[model samples]
Target: MHIVICSSIDFTPQIAQVAQGLTRLGHTVDIPLTSQQIIAGELTLEDYFAEKTNAGESARRKIEHDVIRSYFEKIKMADGILVLNFDKKGIANYIGGNTFLEMGFAHVLNKRIILYRPVPEMLYTDELLAFNPEVIDEDLALIR
Candidate 1:
């Protein structure tokens, strides 16, 4: 199955590993450009975030908006979305705003929603429960 790996920029290394694992399992995987760049060492989290900081709020917002739109396009083309929900700020299975938006896009597109981890008791717990995402833990084969 064609799958798009979705996660925050902070998880780029993990995203690359997950993408590789999915590819090894014979699934086509799509990752964000920022993640790819980070994996290639063409970009770093420090530099990426610094660029956003230097660009100022308005320009940064535009860049983020464009990136989210691009992700929506990828989600529309994919068979499913594999969320790499690692812990953040003490929240296990954390799903940040961007990942949540990607999930919404995939859910609305009728694409499969696969979570690499269980749903966390976060602010969006109710909304995430409503989506009924497939919690795969480490068994990525369940992504199909």
Candidate 2:
């Protein structure tokens, strides 16, 4: 299976580990672009998120760089998307705005939705459940 990983950039390191597991299982994996850059030492986490400090600048950056659209393209070509939903901001199994959007894209595209953890308690919990994601609970063997 060809898989695209969706998660907060904070999980960059863990994403690499997950990619390795998927590879071991004979699956082709693609990590988030930002995470790849950070892991490659070409970009820093802080720098990638710096524009987020200003709402206007963030919006501009997203538009100018085609961030969302590019990810949508990746999702469109993938067989499935694996969400690495680790805890963040005191929320267990956190799924931030971008990851949520990516999940929605995969669902509408009829792509498999895999979650590394259980559904999180958030404003979008109901919507997340609506996606009917398959939870792996950190077991890569269960990816199918």
Candidate 3:
């Protein structure tokens, strides 16, 4: 199946690994530009976050809008979304704001939602549970 890998920029390495595994499994995979940039050594996660933080409000808004719009288009083209929900800030199976938004976009598009790990206790736990994403538990083959 064609799958788009979504995760925080902080997890780009892991996302890249997952993408490689999925590709080896004969699945088509797409990753966000942030991950691509990081993987290509064009920017570090710290630099990316710093750039966003240092940008003016209007510039930040435009950047965010463009990135999200691009991802929405990607989701529309994909068969499903595989979320790399690694633990963050002591929250196991943590899904951050942007990743959660991507999940919502996939859910609305009726694309299958797959999680690298099971949904964990979180602020929006109920909402995430409602989407009923398939938990692969680190196994890329489970995406099907």
Best by lDDT: 2
Q: Candidate 3 residues 1-144, lDDT tens each? A: 999998987888898998999999999999988788788998787787677678584357448759888999999999999999999889998898889999999999999999999998998999999998889888776666
Which residue window of length 10 is worst by lDDT in model 2? 52-61
Task: Evaluate model 2: give its TM-score.
Answer: 0.91
For 1-144, candidate 1 gives per-residue lDDT tens digits of 999998877888889888988999999999987877778898777887777567585356548658888889999999999999999878888898888999999888899999999998987899998888999987877765
Model 3: CA > 4 A from native: 52-65
Q: Candidate 3: lDDT over CA atoms? A: 0.88
Best by TM-score: 2
Report residue 21 deviation for candidate 1 (angstroms): 0.5
Q: Which residue pairs in model 1 clash with each other?
A: none
Clashes of each: 0, 0, 0
Kindly report which residue stretches of model 1 are placed more than 4 angstroms away from their true locations once superposed.
49-65
Candidate 3 collision pairs: none
The worst-scoring run of ten residues by lDDT in candidate 3 lies at 53-62
The local distance difference test score of each candidate is 0.86, 0.91, 0.88
State candidate 3's TM-score: 0.90
- For each candidate in turn, the TM-score is 0.89, 0.91, 0.90
